[model samples]
Target chain A: MNAVLHLAAASRVHGEGATEVHALRGVTFRAHPGELVAVMGPSGSGKSTLLTLAGGLDAPTAGSVWIEGTDLATLDHAGRARMRRTSVGYVFQDFNLIPALTAAENVALPRELDGEKGKVARRLALTALEEVGIPDLADRFPDEMSGGQQQRVAIARAIVGERRLILADEPTGALDTDTGEEILRLLRARCDAGAAGVMVTHEARHAAWADRVVFLRDGVVVDETGADEPEALLVEESGR
Target chain B: MSIRQAMLAILEQGPMYGYQLRAEFEQRTGETWPLNIGQVYTTLTRLERDGMVEVVESAAEDGSDRTHVSYRATESGRSEVSEWFATPVPRTQPPRDELAIKLAIAVTLPGVDVATIIQRQRSATMTSLQDYTRLKRTGRAANPEAPEDLAWSLVLDSLVFDAEAEVRWLDHCEARLRRAAADRPAASAHATPTATPETSDGVAR
Candidate 1:
């Protein structure tokens, strides 16, 4: 099977010499198109670092990162940025929206920054907002919207460019249970729309929404289980 | 500790209200452990039902007032705790966390879009890290001199450790994605090696 994204012997470190901390220790994984994979780990397990490196947001100290048949490390900074803008969509836990901008404007920013025509970007942005079930809220500013609404807008922005890869880091962290679930449903909807999504979350319930869950510990993939497991592992642990 | 053992341990210390039980458990364990109030009460009620513990006295029954119910461990409860203490801890099987499996399958699944997912996860993780850091800072600032400060510090350490680890993992995932993308054509070619059909006429299938 063709991997849409692949990591080979990837490692990331901070600082140098004795002060250096190896956040990712020769870690490797892959994700294909149309897959919704959840990365689960306790604090300091390097899950987010893997996501960012996969998304071309950062460079690895060793090994390579591939997205859509291209080595991101081989790309020039501008080239990497272009690929990310055109192919990758990101949804953050706190819904990283410009509070001053209307939802439509926020969704359009990526395309607009990529130098698309204003009208074309806005039209696509509106379509993306509709995809996330928040078309009516397009005119509302981030501050005016609820947490779920803001997240929907974030999702809208993420999919507006028709990016094939969508990464969400704890997309529901700030929301209440119901609201978080709603955000997760939106992410699922995005996958249904043919965009593969990856989410990093501590909440097992949130991870349960994904088609698969990857467990990490101390910067390594420790275990994995299908989403169809009879009960969430965390719940089972609590039960024990 | 098992739920029954935990209840017995709490009662052995002295009578405690439901909320008090929850707080004390969390405090004693440095909040590395989590117990919902419902879980505590449910366990306590179960102990009472099993005759392992009994309510010595009920302070009040009014709905609006704080009702304090004091419970003491029975002889059986004491025996249970003793057995619990004497028993060696059971080694649990390693968790088969669903997320890791999903990620592994996602990486190899035909036509799956792995990079986008990582990007989305990176954003979400960063946001969570920020929130956790803020909460940790606020907690430390609010209780600089509290006796439970050490416990709070431990929680903060855990939060920081998780957030930092997640961020690092996301980076590693991205790098591997880039490499896989670069190697796709060659890998795919290697995966589809030609094979001869073993029929009457050995023709390539």
Candidate 2:
């Protein structure tokens, strides 16, 4: 399988001297097309740092990040930004929806930003919402929706652009287990549909949806055990 | 074999009690499938409860004057065993254990000392590897030509594989730990407040 996203010897540091904190240290991994790779790590293990760098949301202090053969570090700021806006989707833990926009409108924003007409954006957004099983709630604002519904909307917005890469950080953290599983099923379906994805999650149950699970510690890829049976990954984690 | 088939296979040769069946099974299989005595009795009792087996009156051949209750497969048990033999056993995927999960979670929690955890795991894994190596050596010396020698060798191979993999994993673990320790502040000296964003409910990716 060809890797759609690749990180090689990536490192990210915050501050300097006595206050220096290495968020990522020589981390490396690859996420392939039609695969959902779950990044598992404790709080400061640099899993998020890896994701942000992979998504082009944050630049690595050292090493290279490649998405679809384009090295993020080599691209200009505007080039990277455009790539993220058009080819990548992000699902933040907080949902990050515009407060004033309705669920459909929030999902439509990406398409609209890409120059689609308002009507066309709305139509595409509704289709995206339906994909997440939230078409009926399209007009509802973020505040009016439940946490799970909001996350569904977030997912809708993420895939609305038909981005090849989707980066999610604790995508189901706010929802209960059943709803989380539902969200995971949706993510799995996305992979089945040929979209490459990387999800950072603490919950093993949530990560079980992925084709592979990679363990990170202090910003480096420590272990990877999956790409086959997710249940084995769960058992390995539990045995630890 | 399915549990039913295993039970019937044990009884088909002769009527033996639960403990005897278990001992025979271990002996036959070369102890590859270890079953607790309690589990053996529990399965036997269940088989009896389900009418797949029936108790038979018996006495020890040695005439110890002790009553030994035996069980034989019933007609239904024979059918079940036959069906079991016809059916293919489903292959189970290897276990993805929780150790990786815990290690992943441990690295992300605030105030967690990743280096310390890796060091501790390294030492523990090394100790286990040494113990398994010693056990394998002892087994080889004690039963070089025993009938169960092949089985002992298989067990030794598995242990060696586990230990070798663990040692390699420890090397990776320690390298990452050293990098983390060298890069981060000492846990005790830096009292950074835990980043408890009300919205940050889980470990970030």
Per-residue CA lDDT of model 1 for A1-240, tens digit only, reads 567778887989899976787778777787777778889876787999999998999888999998888989889989999999998999998888998899999999999999999999999999998888888998998889888898899988888878989999989999997688678777877786777788999875566566677766557665565434232212321342
Give model 2's docking category: incorrect
Please report, as a residue range, the 10-residue window in candidate 2 chain B with the lowest summed lDDT.
B190-199
lDDT of each: 0.74, 0.73
Per-residue accuracy of model 1 over B10-64 as CA lDDT, tens digit each:
7788877788777766554434457778888888898899989888755675755
Best by TM-score: 2
What TM-score does candidate 1 reach? 0.53
Docking class of 1: incorrect
* Chain B TM-score of candidate number 1: 0.64
True contacts preserved, each candidate? Answer: 0.00, 0.00
TM-score of chain A of each: 0.92, 0.92
